[model samples]
Target: MKNSQLYIITLVVLTFLGCKELEPRRPKEHSTTNFYKEVIEQNKKLNALETKRIKQTLDRDTLTTYQSSANGFWYTYINKDTVSSQTPIKGDIVTVKYNVTGLQGNQFYDYQTRDYTVDKEDFVPGLTEGIKLMKKGETITFVIPSYRAYGVTGDGSRIGINQTLRSTLTLIEIKKPNNETK
Candidate 1:
């Protein structure tokens, strides 16, 4: 009787221990919200630093007065078209002669003329908007931030990653589309 009672007590203890509730194991560090917040904060810091550097470079140039654009870039008219106020519209074929340089005055590309359909073809985002602000025979110098120009990945050959650029663009001509009347 004593042995049987001992065996029954052991079985009861084992059953009680095994009946304890089971729970799912949770990871200690699984939240992505904190990681994304850190990324955003780092990007803001980077943008602020880049803006400061660009402002310093602009301040050193006394020969030209830079005007900030609504699209997050800066520009100055090298040769303003005072007579004809017409600028290129969307779908207009525009011929432009341009040269690209770094903020430190390092030339990436020499002056070259090319034709593009405004807002239709793929081009530098800043230059595309700047070209809309130009008229035929007018030249303008644009100081573009990296985000507005090339972002992170650059043009592969000349412009490096996240490099600010200074480009002088001359509107050679603007050919309006055939469907539109002059």
Candidate 2:
């Protein structure tokens, strides 16, 4: 009985000693400054590439009359209808038809006619600015850089990362803030 107990104790001790205690895995530590620097550098590179691609597209399409906007998008009105000369403000609701495309001419979305409130935060900066330049019945075409559209992290699907977007907007109607609820 003593021999068996001794053997058991020895076995237990051997087993306990042989077994390794599991350590919790810790993620690698990175400096925030370094991470921020890397992000800034990557943004610079992406901007450079996007600019080059835009230049190439403009050259290929032979687009020379596009006026550069203060916010970096290139735009030109294709047609202007002699309706109301009044453009939209932030509180005004605007009815528009738009076709959004990529630099390679891939269409993203097309709306024959839709209504949107002129909220800058709700849409891309390029589209918001583009709409502000239009009056009722005016149609404008805009070539938006990636920074103004989806930016570095795209729209999570058809639009890839750092992709430039081209969009054409036709303002169908403009409703005043008091008349917009209907």
Best by lDDT: 1
**What lDDT tens digits, residue by residue, belong to model 2 across residues 50-102?**
88788777777765567778988988779975665578888788888988888
Model 1 score (lDDT): 0.92
Off by over 4 Å in 1: 1-21, 27-29, 179-182
Least accurate 10 contiguous residues by lDDT in model 1: 173-182
- lDDT for 71 (candidate 2): 83
Error of 2 at 47 (Å): 0.7
Global fold similarity of model 2 (TM-score): 0.73
Candidate 1 residue-wise lDDT, 1-182, digit = tens: 99999999999999999999999998798669989999899988998999999999999999989999999999999899789988888899899999999988899999999998999999899999999999899999999999998889999898999999999999988888773432
What CA root-mean-square deviation does each model show from the true structure? Answer: 3.4, 5.6
Report residue 47 deviation for candidate 1 (angstroms). Answer: 1.2
Residue 182 lDDT in candidate 1: 24
